[model samples]
Each structure stands twice: as structure tokens, then as C-alpha cells.
Target: MASSRPKNAPFLFPTFNSSVLPDPSRFFSHDLLSAPLPTNSFFQNFTLKNGDQAEYFHPYIIKSSESSISISYPSLSHNSAFIYEAFNADITISGSDEPDQHSRKTHLISSFSDLGVTLDFPSSNLRFFLVRGSPFVTCSVSSGNSSIKISTIHAVLSFTGNSSSTKYTAKLNNNQTWLIYASSPINLVNDGGSSINCGGGFSGIIRIAVLPDSNPDFESILDRFSCCYPISGDADFTKPFALEYKWEK
Candidate 1:
């Protein structure tokens, strides 16, 4: 299948190697490479890294040939009001060759208290290895007590399979089912620890906001964060990205 390439960005994708890719006949059903992507939403494009070795703000899941992991982010728009409430969020991340087996699962949902905000990935199959090319949201519960954490992360997809959408079904704590979508066609590739795409060059930058005029320990607050820098604009800095809570009422 021929890939309709995007205009090259400043950075470029790594050289493609047919040797490491899986055979088409064994893993494909259709030509997903020509499938259309959802408009406005950027595709997650990058390689997976081990959790301990990844930099802060760049969270990811270990790749597994047997099973693909699924993630559901809070549904909100880029201009939606930022989260300012005190609620917890949970994330369930996992990866494996066989998701049905209990033994292959290695990750689970992690609870972040006081904030009611957690990013859960099942601890049974994969580890959280965050990287750049993604941005996380933050919130202020009250004066003197604010929290900043990852709310979203994305990467380009690559795999050894026949034509497929690369989506998987998983249930939430409420027993609700959601589809985890992969950045199909693998439009990007990993290069020197960064996500490089055909649209441009390597830009492993994730946007973040610092509380406005609220004199606090900025460095300490962002200790786990790296490669973060300020983006100048007239908009209020207190409000960074949009958010929605999944906590119980």
C-alpha cells in the first residue's frame, strides 16, 4: 500500500526498514494506510520507551506484539474552560501479547488523591513511559494548593500486522466499554528519542502553563517535567488546556 505522505516538517522520520516490519499477509485485512484520519485532532506519533527511562510529561505504554493497549482521555475541546475543581482522575494503561490472560497484564489504574484526577493505565501488561509531542492539563484546587499532571499523551503508530484500524475494546471502572485508537498508517517514526514526522522535523515539545502571579515554587512543581518552555501569548496563563473529571458525585 502506498502512503500519502505529508509535507516534510523540519525534522524527518527515521529511515524505514522492511526487515523489522511484520509480514502483511499475517496481520492485515484491509489497507488502513489509506484510511482517513479524524480532522482537527492530531495523530499520536512516536516510539514507546521504558517507563523509568522516559522524561517527565512524556508518558507512554510499553509496546506488546500480542496485545494493544487502550486509553480514554477526558472529552473536552481545546477552548473548553480549564478544570478548577477538586476531583480525582484515574488512568488504566496496559499492553500484552494476550490481553485476555490475567498473567500478561502488568499495569493498573492509579489513584491520585486530593486532586480527584488520575491517569490510569493497567499495571499488568505495560509501564507508563511518557514523552514529548504531547501536552498535559493542570488545575488549581484552591489558593496555596494546586496540582499539575499529565492529562493526555499521543504517539505515531507502527506495527507488524496486515491492514487494520489498530483499535481495541476495553472496559472502564463503571464497566463501560471504550475503543482505544492507534495512529494508524504509522505516519511518524522515532529518531534520537523524539517523534519525527513527514510533515516537519523533530519537535518533541509539549505545551504547558504556569500559574499566573501566584508566587510558588515553579521549579519544584515541575521537577518531574523536562524540555518545558513558556509560549508567549495574551491569553490568561492560569488556564492552560481543557479538562473534564470522571470522579463520582
Candidate 2:
């Protein structure tokens, strides 16, 4: 079954060799050119699992669990020094620490199972997910051109039943404008918390994929989703940085 997924959230994805990825056009309508990142001066900030405070942040993508793993980016404005906002300028990110405020490199990455947000590591059975910091503040797609590669991503896991400490890793695809594959059913509460649905003494790996926004293949998946389930929300809006942490047993 399909669950509500944010188009821009950082999601844990698995590489599927399957030649079959349903078309996405049926499920999505908002195009990138029609909706650009917010250009307004006002900023919005949703608290993140991390203790650091922020005003305008966005988790461009969250991992696969219903738990919200936000990837936040600072807002775009002329006053912000990190970004050169003039027309025809290339996008950029920076690090700053002037004592009055806290700043770090534009990239921010954390896993729900690692943050101690929910379960204590010693008591939980979940293996940590190794990933790069999220919302790396360097991504932009020209209005006329619909394709862009933000960066390469990776994830690692060891099966729950496996006794060996060995873990498997995969590099995620960066072609799509937006995509999310949840290997399991996860619930996303309005407040950005989550619970997993692994039950009945059954535990196995699940794989999901988000095809590139430009891929003709995405249109097919979206089409099926629309016919069976209507798509809601403007696909182009940036999801605010959210609260999510995990515990395994």
C-alpha cells in the first residue's frame, strides 16, 4: 500500500534492479518550472530533531520511514550572504560563525535511529543508517531545463535476522526531480513523528524508488496512482524541516 510522501523530502531508497518502475505522470501534476522555491523574504522554520534552532529551513528529502527525517536549507534572499541572489547568478552555500549566531556548512545530515530522538541505542535493535548530511544547500534547476543532480546519496543496512555484522550499501539515483520508496509502511503524523508497521514475527528488507522528474517512466506510475488514488498537494512546495527520530526493538 502507498502512503503520503513528500516530493522534496530526503528519503531512504533502495536500488531495485527491476525493469519495472510505474510511470509517475499519473500521480503528479505540479511541474518545477511552474513552481520555484519560495522567493519571498519571510522565512519559515519547523524545529528539527537536532537541538540547533533555525528560522527558514527545508528538508528537501526525508528517508523511507514514516518518521520525519528533515533536510533543511536556509532561505533565499538578497540579504543572505551565503547565497548570491542576483539574477543569472549560480547558487552557492557557505559556513559562518561570528559568535552572535550559529552557522555551519550548508549540508545537514542525520538519521532517525541515531539522533536518540525516540529509543535509546542500547535498547533498540535498529542498525544505524549511514548517509550524507541532508539538504546540502546547493541545488537549483533552471526554469527552462527540468533536470538537475543535487548529489550522489548512499544507505547501508544489515538484515534483522543476520548474525554477521556485515552491512549492505547502495548508491541512490539522483535523476528524478522528486521520488520516495518506502520498503515498509510508515505513518507520518501531522507533527512529523512516526511509527513502523513491521509485525507478526516477519522481518525482511523492503525497497522503494523515486524515478527522476524528467524520466518518461515516472509519468506511468503517477498515472496509475491517480486512477486508483487521487494526488493532492502542490508537488513543488518545499517541506519544512521536521521532527523525527527512531528506536528499534
TM-score of each: 0.19, 0.20
Q: Write the per-residue lDDT of candidate 2 for residues 19-70, one digit (tens) a residue.
A: 5433222111234223322322112111222322233222322321211122
Q: What C-alpha lDDT, on a 0 to 100 scale, does residue 129 get in candidate 2?
A: 30
The C-alpha lDDT values of all candidates are 0.26, 0.24
What lDDT does model 2 reach? 0.24
True-structure lDDT of candidate 1:
0.26
Runs of candidate 2 exceeding 4 Å displacement: 1-80, 84-122, 133-201, 207-249
Model 1, clash count?
53
Worst 10 residues of 2 by lDDT: 88-97
In model 2, what lDDT does residue 188 have?
Answer: 13
